[model samples]
Target: MDFSDTIGVSAAGMNAQSTRLRIAAENLANKDTTATTHGGDPYRRKTVTFKEELNRQTGVSSVKVKEIGQDQTPFEQRYDPAHPAADAKGYVKMPNVNSMVEIMDTHEAQHSYEANLNTMQITRSMLTRTINLMK
Candidate 1:
């Protein structure tokens, strides 16, 4: 295995995790956003997907964000008669995002990002030591 391979692999993982975290944050931010303009629908939750791809030069399997897409799950309904966007039946359509779920996903994404960062740091230290030994 090449000494620089670890850095390259870890960087890819970090990038993917960063994207995941960004999407999770967006979902959380828009969790309660309702329609404002005419014919506008309430904010829908977004989801991130990851897929493995072979690096063209290194031939290593790397994780990449497959897509950032809308959540197909049904929107939530809440009884809010006073709300402007509320329906005639005293119900308002809410985003499908759940705060608890989003926070948990954020935590997982943060952990994954940290793991990749640690791998990069370790690889750098190893490379530094290897260079010192040659001097």
Candidate 2:
């Protein structure tokens, strides 16, 4: 196996984690949003799905985002008679995003991204040392 393949694989992982982080941020931002119209659907939580693909050039498996889909979980109902989005029963539908869950996801993505970055840095160092020794 080529040593440079490690950097390529790690870069793919970092990209995937970045996408995940973005999705998590979007979900957190919309967590408090409600539908503007009565009895309308509120902003649903978003989720990212990852897939692995083989790099034809290096034969290494790399990570990629398969899809960014909405969470299927039901929305939460809050009683607020004064809310413009309230239904006939004085209930407003809230986004399904859970702040705690989104926070955890964001943390995970950050850790993964950092790990990939470290791997890439180490690979670069190894390559640099090899080139120096050849001189």
Predicted model with the maximum lDDT: 2
lDDT against the true structure, per candidate, is 0.85, 0.93
Please count the clashing residue pairs in each candidate, in the order shown. 0, 0
Give the per-residue lDDT of model 1 (tens digit) for 7-119.
88899899998998888899888888987543346888888888998977877887888989988888888887788787768687788899999999989999999999998
Window of ten residues with lowest summed lDDT in model 2: 1-10
Candidate 2 clashes between residue pairs 3 or more apart in a chain or in different chains: none
Top TM-score prediction, candidate number = 2
After superposing candidate 2 on the true structure, give the runs of residues whose Cα lies further than 4 Å from its correct spot: none
Q: How many backbone clashes can be found in candidate 2?
A: 0
Return the TM-score for each candidate structure.
Answer: 0.92, 0.96
Question: For residues 1-135, could you state the per-residue lDDT of candidate 2 as single tens digits?
Answer: 667789888989999999999999999999999999888899999999999999887778989999999899999999998998998899999999999999999999999999999999988999999999999
Off by over 4 Å in 1: 37-40
Q: Native-vs-model 2 lDDT?
A: 0.93
